[model samples]
Target: MLSYIYALAGQFQLTHERLSDMPAAPPVLLSDRQTEVLKWAAAGKSRGVTADIMNISEAAVDDHFRRIFKKLNCNDKVVAVLRAMSSGIIHL
Candidate 1:
């Protein structure tokens, strides 16, 4: 069971080097709201928690993540945050 779980998890893992290997695009410009959402996401907050903290709907939080992902050219939140920080787009 544990091996199966590990294999399943491995299928979804994204390494930092893999993310870095993506084309060196220009720094992505994010809206203020999207920046805030990215910060919350980096802190390991769930969509519902981020929504509450920002006083917005969960759907809005999801939308923000969608836009963030597109803007950052990353498929996952971790990669997006890493790229943002490395590109000087966000401090944290």
Candidate 2:
């Protein structure tokens, strides 16, 4: 039983190391609409305001943000904007 436990622990360590070494997915290019939305967001516009200015629904703005986050691998608006800018996906 002790040997089995040690073997299991070794296996877990190996799996963890392999997973940690795995490279992240490559960045995806943003669509024109997505870049537009990110530009508005970077300008400090709220989603509602962006939606109003773009003549799009608030839900559509949210959807755009969601896709942006996914493409940028960000979990928050600030990070998403930063990533978008740094990646040349959007400009000020």
Candidate 3:
């Protein structure tokens, strides 16, 4: 799986800067689950649909959004997506 590959790769000497080419990118500090949730968010997925696809509860999806918003310092989803795009975490 992708998470397993990233985990295996993390055991080596490469650091965050080497992991991401963009200067404005945020540190690669998110957990795999968080990254997955963010990717879904970036794709314009609603909380309920994302939860169904991810096999998590709607409340769990809300919880992820709360953490994501706080972490990215975004007041809303639009700002979150913009911030994430600027940070090279995703492209739209």
User: Could you give candidate 2's per-residue lDDT for residues 11-84 as a string of tens digits?
Assistant: 56445644796774577788888888989978989989999999999999999888888887665676667666
User: Model 3, stretches more than 4 Å misplaced?
Assistant: 1-28
- For model 1, how many clashes? 0
Q: Model 3 — which ten-residue stretch has the worst lDDT? A: 6-15
Candidate 1 vs candidate 2: the TM-score winner is 1
TM-score of each: 0.73, 0.69, 0.63
The Cα RMSD in angstroms, rounded to one decimal, for candidate 2 relative to the true structure is: 12.7
User: Which one wins on TM-score?
Assistant: 1
Compared with the true structure, what per-residue lDDT tens digits does model 3 show for residues 46-76? 8889999999999998887788778876546
lDDT of 1 by residue, 1-92 (tens): 86456434433443444456665577588999999998897787998999999999999988998999898766677767777776677785
Error of 2 at 56 (Å): 0.4
Model with the higher TM-score, candidate 1 or 3: 1
| Steric clash pairs (candidate 2) | none
Question: Would you list the clashing residue pairs of candidate 3?
Answer: none
